[model samples]
Target: MKVAVMGAGAVGCYFAGMLARVGHQVALVGRPQHVEAFNTRGLRLETKAFDETIAVKASTDAAIAADAELVLFCVKSPDTETAGAQLAPHLAPDTLVLSLQNGTDNAERLRTVMAQPVAAAVVYVATEMAGPGHVKHHGRGELVIEPAAGSRDAADALVAAGVPTEISDNVRGELWLKLILNCAYNALSAIAQLPYGKLVEGPGIPEVIAQLVTECKAVAAAEGVTLADDVDSAVRKIVQTMPGQFSSTAQDLARGKPSEIDHLNGFIVARAQAHGLSAPANLTVHALVKLIESKAQ
Candidate 1:
């Protein structure tokens, strides 16, 4: 399959590299430096199993997706609409656009700008851009995606490329669960610049994570989302599974780039207000991260 990865950051590059490794035609649309690196020496994929450079095409232009059969919409939450618009004119009619993002509504946001079939995916992966055109994987690469027109085929391709995938009917709840996890850890990791295990080792951090998860659950309940019964276990598993992994928000802050805190914890705070509920934990962390971001401006 011919695939295009929009906003080819760490997550995008990982998937693009995996597909390319399996002999698929993969093209990446990203910044100039990574594009140059990709064209020069391919993508350096560092994983626990092995490290290899996989050859793939790269370009700064969204038109790189012109012939793509599958389009991985991997831009950050804030760039969803703009990036969608950039790629809108280039997509084929039958292209399956899977949103591999943090927020719950990125696929919906993308739909406003494009007429292609869009699916929302809950991505469970720990990866980071170690450097230009390089993606380092920490652990767990699986996707739970909502069904779309070509979603099954896409899932088959992803599974064949070593990415475990499942098609679920309740992606809204899945998205909420992922959001709750992000709220529980992303800000704490960002503020402390610590990995998951080390962040949890801090005094009072576990209590704070519990409070954030509770607040997020309340907001999600108010929104009529019925999350999994074992969300707490899932929260605990992050530290065990990806002990050395920093939250994506942490990576963003270290790079002095904007984070999706507004859509993670901030979204909970906003929804709590709409439902006449209080989310002080989420509010506090959201404010703190926003303050840090403000200084970065």
Candidate 2:
């Protein structure tokens, strides 16, 4: 299948490289630097098993998505509407758009500006851009995508290309679970510029994480999302699983780039308000991140 990755960030580059490695026609739409690097030297894919360069088409134009059978909408949550608008005119009638992003509502937000079929997907991968056109995989690479018009075929193609993908009916719940995990760590990591291991080591930090999870769970429950019983455990396990990794929000802040914190904890705060509930914990961190962002300007 012909695939177009719309953002070409860490997630986009990783998945695009995977499919391209398997001989699928793949094009990555991203910033000029990364696109230039990819066009000239191929994408360097680094993983534990092997490190190799995979040649794929790269462009800075959203118009590159014009003939793609599958389009991975991998922009940050804040860019959902803008990117969707840019991609809308370029997409073919039968194209399938998958939201492989951080937050829960990206797919819903993307749907507002486009006519193509959209599906929400949960990504469980640890990847980073080691450099321009270079993606380093740290760990797992499984996906759980919501059912859509051609999701089954998309999942099959993804699986055949070495990406483990599942079509899930409970993607909302899955998204909420992921949100809870982010709420527990991303802001704290950003504020302190610390990895999960060190962040949790601080006094009262674990309690603060627990408070955030409690508030997020209340909001998720209000939204009628049935999160797993082990959601708390899942949130706590991040420190053990990704001890050395700073949250994406931390990475964004350090690089002077905007983050998806609004869609993570801020989304919890908004939904809590909507349901006549309060997520003070989430609101506090969300406000802090926003303050830092404002001060950086």
- TM for every model, in the order presented, reads 0.99, 0.96
Model 1: per-residue Cα lDDT over 127-237, one tens digit each: 999999999999999899999999999999989999999999999999999999999999999999999999999999999999999888888888999895478999999
Taking every candidate in turn, the Cα RMSD to the unseen true structure, in Å, is 0.7, 1.3
Full-model lDDT for every candidate: 0.93, 0.90
Clashes of each: 0, 0
